[model samples]
Target chain A: MILVIGGAASGKLDYVKSLGYSDSSISDGFIGEEPVVYNLQALVAKDPEKAPGYYDELVGKEIVICDEVGSGIIPATREMRDAREATGRLCNRLAISADSVIRLVSGIPVKIK
Target chain B: MDFLLTGGAACGKSTYAEKLVLGFPKPRFYVAAMRPYGEESFIRIKRHRKMRAEKGFETIEKQTDVDEIELPPHSTVLLECICNLVDNVMFDDQGNMYDVTDRIISEVLTLKSRAENLIVVTNDVGSEYSDYSAGVKAYVQAIGDINIALAQSFENVYELVCGIPVVLKGELR
Candidate 1:
């Protein structure tokens, strides 16, 4: 029930490790079990349609990491736009349900919840 | 009272502002400050309108000259953003940068005085370290300047990070 989010390579993993999550417990996406730290962005990118279900399962247990990909200039291509929208929607859902939300900026963790 | 909401792009400032406005007394107005001059802007404006379509907000599209908008006294008003208002006043109308910040301050003060609750939404445009065009840089500076002024003037100022509100000034309530 923790959401760790930031821009690409903003040290999301380092912070997750700081929390003592084992590497083996982490995952790129869900596979019927909650990873110690799940990369929510990768799962959304792999199949945007599965994001809602992943979120449903990960809502109250998994520690999720998602990249902040919706900021800056809006995308011109429909595909990129869809990806951005999907990421934003999923993050918003997690933000609401997660007990804690942390935003990493330059390896610094700023607690938002 | 005035409430200022600021955050990076797509960081849920608008949605947060919407929720704030909803908590106040009605005759709620959403003051949109973007001109649909190009394809991208047109798409953005349409999307914004659709987002607030069900929020019981009577949309007022005014890119600049916010002081010109007519509102009933004691109504809650949400100025969608200050960044776009500065952009419209500067690049869109070729307004001088030196005076743009002052003008926005005056307009915002005027708007604030006219409402029971004024929630101003703005972006944290200068936080990014990327280089931008001269015009874009000027716009960023203008927004930063106005945001500082707003932070001082408003009783409540908040910055959203990943959809969580951080109070910079007054209490959230």
Candidate 2:
């Protein structure tokens, strides 16, 4: 499994695509061959409980891309904060078993294993 | 063993640091830098405290003056954040960036000396180009400088990318 992470507009998806995984292989919502779970935070926002199960199924199988959305000023609303924390927790779980983890800073990939 | 953990907000720096400290010997201390300023901060503090509970950690709440705090001999300490300490020291006073950065670096060095192992947590807030006010920009600069100094001094530095620990300086144990 490979995990790709970066902030907004950090070109995480482009970096993953450069690795040879085409658009057809990457799945935005459903799990598939080379599933690219871009914006994992959105899944948490929609259903926090189901998010972890989705991550569990993707371990060692999917290529994940997510924004580092936890930073900046703390959110005012409770729902937003919950979503942020849930996203962070889910990422931690995914990273522990991931074969490789890459961080993209301004479209540059830095390997973090 | 000195460890420096940094990442964007909510990237799981705190959770990873907490896990790292457990690898060392007992008498662990969690040095919390954030104050309960308002509702959001209070919620964060509560969550962090809950996370640390029953983890064999003794929590020490200090905004600044970290060097002045007494630690048990040969104990491991986790500084929950460096940016909050910077804010506490620089928020009221209009000090120059160099002085503030130096102050923080000095304090971190002192703490490092006192503890057998120090796990320092910091946020990467300067990565993005922002239209924030002058004060915020200065704050970001201070954090960036302090991170560099600490990373150079500490044996290990890990940047958490969406909860994934990426080692930039030294290996993680």
Backbone collisions counted per model = 0, 2
For model 1 chain B, the run of ten residues with the poorest summed lDDT: B90-99
Name the 10 consecutive residues with the lowest summed lDDT in model 1 chain A.
A29-38
Candidate 1 accuracy as lDDT:
0.79
Best candidate, lDDT: 2
lDDT of 1 by residue, A1-113 (tens): 88998887899989998988877878665544546546666667777766677666777566888887765544557666666667777788789888899989899998889
Q: Candidate 2, residues B1-173: lDDT per residue as tens digits?
A: 99999877677888889999999989999999986777868878998889999999999989998998798898999998997898787876455433489888999899999999999999877765558778787787888889998988999998777666777888867
**What is candidate 2's CA lDDT for residue A68?**
70
Per-candidate TM vs. native?
0.82, 0.81
lDDT of 1 by residue, B87-146 (tens): 676753454545489999999999998989999998776654466778667666777889
**What TM-score does model 2 achieve against the real structure?**
0.81
